[model samples]
Target chain A: MIEIFDLEKRYGFTYAIRDINLKIETGEFIGLIGPNGSGKTTLLKLLFGYCRPTHGHIRINGQPPSPKTNSFITFYPEIDSLYGNMRVFRLIDWYSRFFTDWNKETEKKLIEFFNIPLNKYVRQLSKGFRARLKLLLSLSRDADIFLLDEPLSGIDPASRDKIVSAILREYRENQTIIFSTHIVSEAETLFERTIFLMDGSVILDGKSDDLREKYGKSIDTIFREEMYA
Target chain B: MNTMEFERDRPIFLQIKSAVKERIVRREIKKELPTIRGLAVELGVNPNTVARAYRELETEGIIGSRVGKGTWVIPEALQEIRKEMIEDIIDKFLNNLHSIGLDSKEIKEILEGINDRDI
Candidate 1:
């Protein structure tokens, strides 16, 4: 389980997120949703220990977020920071060697599923393929918690479908996944629980089915009508 | 696996339940229902939603499952499902008629007129 207590993050007197508290259980699939500049990325960065919280704290399985805790967590950043000049196959080889728990079978399957061109250099691939490569690298690890930041952003509809399918295919029953995305309509069904973030604060958090039952609307519709409106 | 289209104004598990019932009534699911995980993946939904639908179906005696075997439609599920669907249609029909200011006498007259036409 992961616990957050009165978490806050500030940069130069501006608050990115504040008064945040959440408890994520094992094996739950959660969606962190908000529009751009809502601090979705900042919250994810804090959870992964990319930056320290200015106040409060987070605990993962009774331990604070650190290099030791990070070993069991896999983070897929929204940015493309892979080596631009490296060939895909060579990059995979070099990347896989860093993780002791990397699964070669999963790597092979995702490569085919994403239809990634192994001969192409990272700089030569399209935006969709680059996103797929990042997802592949993150998901190939046997991590207990996967923090995916906008895995579907800026991709074509067909490629988005493929990416969603690959995520489902690799989902283990015991793994906990928290993926942040604003494209709620395309990915709402995958979330068992959803947290709606607005202006750096959580406005809604509940089981997806319960929310649907109460509002008589899909999560996408709820986000639009309640959050955006 | 084909992704199922869902309505935007209903709980997904309820939609899944009706989808399974329609399939059973149509004989598309003759013997065994797909495993919850398999259907969840096929429908692009969470496994818990599918499990809840299956649980409701079991409670309603529409389907049954065993440990080694899989979930299957009950022997009398077709007739029961048909009856339930008829009830739903009748309820909607009555509600629509009531909303349009038609009473039982007027509804009976309309039914009689249709029977007489027989065209």
Candidate 2:
């Protein structure tokens, strides 16, 4: 369980996300989304405790978000962070050493299913393959909370669908899955709940179907209206 | 389960209700099988959303409760629910059809054409 009380992240002077109060119960699949530069990354990092909030508090379970809490949380950034020269299997081995929650069996299965070469350096992989590696790294962790930032980015439509499906498979009964993306429609099919972000704040959030039912339009339609329409 | 979920400024309970409805229609839930807290915990959804879904299902007669037995699915689940859904859509379909100045007869013809195509 994560309770964010009046959470505020400051960048110099202006607010990245200000005085926002949200409670995400354990096990819910939440899609944290906002427009570009709308603090989507900021909010996620704040929740993940990567960046300090200038004010307010974020309490996960009972304690503040910290490295101790890191074991229970797994974050998948839109970009890559693995060592390029390291072999894929080696990277998994390194991560498993750092996080005891790493499941070797799951890692092997993902490697086989994705057909990721165990011997090749991660840097040699294509952009799509690299993204898959990031996803694999994130999914392989047996954490209770997942903060996936734009898992669908830079991928083609067919692959995007596959990634979304993979996300569904990764969701466990006792965990929380939070994914952020700009293309709501692409992820709408798997969207149990969605959060619409613009200008660094959550402008809309709800179950995906409820948003469509209330707005009388699909999430994509709503995005068009919110951003440009 | 103390999971924090915001409707993110939108109606959340409604979405939950529909998702539960789908499960109920498929008989994936046997009604009153899992308590609200358990369901919320299992689904990783907010307890409020689970409560709302239960409320709506009860109102629509898809599920019911006994004093101690908790919520249970109705035996005759799918037929009535599907019929209800079709009736629910008919109004919206007709309204959209009316917006284009089409009458019931024309709408029926179009639906028949669609049905024929599927067959």
Q: Indicate the worst ten consecutive residues by lDDT in candidate 1 chain A.
A: A164-173
Q: What is the DockQ score, from 0 to 1, of model 2?
A: 0.09
Cα deviation at B52, candidate 2, in Å, is 10
Stretches of candidate 1 above 4 Å error?
Answer: B1-3, B66-68, B97-102, B109-119
Cα TM-score of candidate 1: 0.92
State the weakest 10-residue window (summed lDDT) of model 2 chain A.
Answer: A161-170
Q: What is the DockQ of each candidate?
A: 0.61, 0.09
- Model 2 Cα shift for residue B6 (angstroms): 24
How well does chain A score by TM in each candidate?
Answer: 0.98, 0.94
For residues B1-119, write the lDDT of model 1, one tens digit per residue: 25579875678889899999988888888989998888888898887778889999999999999988999999887998999998998999989999999999999898789897858
- Expressed between 0 and 1, the share of native interface contacts present in candidate 2 is 0.02
